[model samples]
Target: MVTSSILVLFLLGLTAAAVLAAASKVLHVKEDPRIAKVEGCFPGANCGGCGYPGCSAAAAAIVKGDAAPEICVAGGAEIAENIAAIMGTEVSFKEPKVAQNICTGGSRANLLFDYEGVEDCRAEALLYGGEKSCGIGCIGMGTCVKVCSFDAIRLNADGLPIVDMNACRSCGKCAEVCPTGAIRVSGMTMDLLHLNKVDDCLAPCMQKCPAQIDVRTYIQQMKQGDMRGALLTMKERNPLPLAVGRLCPAPCETICRRNIADEGVAIHTLHRFVADWEMNSGSRVRLDCNPPSGHRVAVIGGGPAGLSCAYFLRRIGHEPVIFEKRESLGGMMKGIIPEYRLPEKVVEWEIQTILDLGVDVRNGVEFGRDVTLESLEKEGFEAVFMATGAWKVPGLGIENDDAEGVVDAVTFLDEVGESIDALSGKRIVVVGDTNTAMDVARSAARLGADVSALISCIQRKMSANKNEVKRAAELGSDLKFLTEPVRVIAEDGVVKGVEYRELQYDDPKKATGTPKPVEGTETVLDADMVVIATNRLVDVDALKDQNGEPLFEMDKKTGGIKADKTTLQTSIPHVFAGGEAHTGRNIIIQAVADGRRAARAIHHYVTEGEIPEPKNPQLRVIPESILKNMQVVYNIPRIRVPEISVEERRSTFKEEVKGFVEYDEARKEGSRCLRCGLTCYDAEAGAEYAADPDVSRFDESGKE
Candidate 1:
């Protein structure tokens, strides 16, 4: 029996050895001999300094003739020569390139205005060539710093970007990203610096944008019947083109060079036309997200800022769960803007698109109540974004503000937008001179109310947009300027009349000139409803810390959240704030731009583990031609966006701007574009040169 067992064991050992040998022979991969030779000749830094997977992969590719031998900078001339000898090839020595700032002057440069508008360089540029002496000078807005994938640039005290030569990779990313073309890629030596020449007539508007979108490209595309391409070009910079096109205040118009001939080429309208066409044509602009990152982010509020932050986070493969306090999306957009100006369907479409991007929308969930920040953190949320808009209305210091029939402008507008018949046919008095008051008066008039807008400042000094104010007058709404409403007379519990005093302007030239109430010039007007269109404030108490102190605090004086201006982050590292809470009540375009910027800040904070410093922000500059044509008569009636009819609009919560253009109108409007982006390029030089690369090369070769 022992002899038989020994024989079986010996056979088993022999069979196992044969099986091992066969497996080894079948699975063994032939190692590339050239890889080791190339690696040996390399610096062996394994720094991944080259734009490749690793040193081994790069070496293998170099051996296979897939990459240039001179790619490994650390290897230097000696290593390059060695690798070349091994590969049987010669390499040409190339000059090292370093990042350089084209613009020299910084904050010391002269300014045209204070530029107290949006913080974004692009938004500021849209509002009249920015407040710089040189039209192409940097605004110090820091858009490039925000967009840098690597922390290689920073804004100095003079509002100029200081590039870290060691950190810079000469990728030309900063140059491509610079709106003003202020940041250029040149050789480490001074030889290339002399080669860099400035374009004297660069468009200031294009220089201010963060995305560096070629404004002229889309305008040319639109002129060439390539509306689809025009829209696509815009989408390359901003995914929510339609929404921005519809609501953007068009700072670009303020600095348009064509204003010298006529009103700025209705650039916003052209953008809207192409954007709407693309949407209706079923070309949805959806972002391609990375694979699931297994990380989660909780975004509070569904306003533009929160939604924008969530959208960008999802694009980076992070799971963002938006906790909206309201039942629907578009926090202030749905609540504040009337349906006529911005339709529900449009808002719904935008929100749905964001939702479709893998963002988990949890509506009707109030932050701090339904889900606390601490609770979210415990639930595995790596980061949180607080974008709750300023919802509280500022009160007028008048005595009868609390009287019946007295209403806050925001509350009244929200009610009217939600239900038009809430107080229809009632005589309404809107106090204040800003756009909100104008919008309230116009909306009330359309709702069948006898609307009267009273302004403390003179007609010329009113804060409302002149075009919108004129539209209100054309719509039969009474606009009383230089009349300040001081006392509200109440009969029993309801408001009976409003007593106003006339005022005289001290300076007729300024928009907010000094005004003095004229003695013995009091008047009374009968009204059933009085809406105070004063100011909007944020409720920071709702966002409290563990100790019950406000987690995200704002300056008591300015009401701006005490947060990093560049990162949009509050004192709390995980919490970020934006929009009305940071900038107060501003234009929709500015708000949208802020949201987009905040998204970038939040992305870096969560992933890169560092808050990027602000860099030189570009400012928009109005051309002399555009300034010459800024006559009051040059203002053409704004092309109203298409909407449902007034009759249909009043019956339900439908839109009211029923004026869509056909293909012909759209084309004509597109042609009317002054081509704001064109100013950036030397049109004379560009026209002289051919756009086709092959044709230009052929011409050059023939000349040679």
Candidate 2:
């Protein structure tokens, strides 16, 4: 009976084994070996940083060709290469990106209400925008910190999460968990090309600055005694910091938060101080460039705009060749600006530093004269940037304007450059009241030319740079306000004098007018030379196409090259124009800004094949009510920039404003900055949101 039972059990076991073997063969599924190998290449943290559910899902997607090999951002380049090897495919990687918190407000952010709830940001954000006046600000409840599996983020004392750049793996976990959408995973190129948005935390000074220099960041760096860092901050936007610092009229200072109190922070002086420190340190600040992109761009005009464009182009891995008409770089900065304002040595040092970064600069190479667009394209230039400055001086509509002694500002400055001593004992009368007029008058006086009169059609208060007008007055130039030059009094084709007339305006405040000439106020002022200090127009004749046709559309109003105001692109898609060529005669800082914009536009055109339109305005200006409410009330006096005595200033061609003598002085001046932001300012400033019940959504009874 036992033997029969054992045999029966053995037969049953054999039947079950045969069934299992059949099932195994029937249910067998084919699997790609690459998927498991790709999975192995991943960190296997199951972080969900790759948009997929986990490493296994991402590996499957990568192996199946549904996703790129570089999909695993957490695993980074090593994993990408390993996956590529496993899949036997080439990997196309994106520019590496890091997560950054875009929101500037933290503890300083205006609060809607004090929250006493759960610590999770997601939970608190559900409660009427998470206690912040700005609806888009970080909730500061450590949700991003919790979601970051790599321990890359930690909350600072301000309750703001600061990402540890070294520990960050470029994963999107923290960004995904951010309730306020403040965290941004951005590429390096995008950061550099970012324009101001309405929602951005831009300061008043930053918005007002044409170059878009981060005035706050540089000032903070200065306060920290990081002179090199401050200079680099400025150079990121304005490549010619040393020159711009010396020449900028300080438009940024006019909108400074400190203006609400005693005076604006001495931004111009501090700006020059940092740049001077960099030059005086004897060691140059060198920036790292990307790998060569195998693209070449032709930049016309070696002025501020062209040099700036070349610097930025070289920085982004493209080769740029600057074709300059002059013997050296620094168009107006070197040639037109007096040596006393922007020294030639300083200009040379800054320009050489830009050229050192693999930029090919060809001096004495005129654009239309030596090279044309067709020739440049034939030479393998991918694109052309026309930055030819406004060099053409329009003729005054007076009789015999071409007299021997009658000359434009450019011609006068050029002759002065040749020999200042030649002007000795010569009588000169400079017309107009612009900054150039003041410069011309002062230069002629220094060279021993008797500056007979500095005449203007407008009132003295309406002239450019009142301080400059004051300085010119101190130098013994006769001021003639509301005086118009009717004609050039010439004898034997020589400028004998200028026929003038006195004018009165209906509105004294207005700079412009259709004045009624006083009947008996007309007079002639004797002069050996008459310098016409008027507007400079773009040399449109120089900008021509291969067929000798107008290369760019012209602005009928200004007669300047008509390009896309934002991108600076010309009628021809691949060509661009900037600086005085497009904007006529603007400030040096604005030219630098144009250069930066053109560089960005050209880069996109070459690499991406299209220039992306800006999502918002280039500059974001906060409301006056908001700005006024955000001021930090303090009566700190503006530190006066050390300058040579008027007696010493007149004797030589030296820099007028001596930069901050000591670093401590600069730091002290920097401290006067209100550190203003979009919706927030220094905490010392009285709280507008909390104090005004009408501004808050919650009732006085504390109910929303």
Highest lDDT: give the candidate number: 2
Overall lDDT per candidate, in order of appearance: 0.67, 0.80
The alpha-carbon deviation from the true structure for residue 101 of candidate 2, after best TM-score superposition, in angstroms, is: 3.1
How many clashes in each structure? Answer: 18, 0
- Regions of candidate 1 where Cα sits further than 4 Å from its true position: 1-57, 60-202, 207-214, 225-228, 236-239, 417-425, 508-513, 545-548, 619-660, 668-704
**What TM-score fits each model?**
0.67, 0.89
lDDT of 2: 0.80
Where model 2 places Cα greater than 4 Å from the true spot, the runs are 1-29, 61-72, 75-94, 179-181, 452-463, 509-512, 545-548, 618-620, 624-626, 629-633, 685-704
Give one digit per residue, the lDDT tens place, for model 1 in 145-237.
Answer: 776545788999878898997876565666765666667776522211121123422344454443344465677687678876776567544
Steric clash pairs (candidate 2): none
The candidate 1 region of ten consecutive residues with least summed lDDT is: 188-197
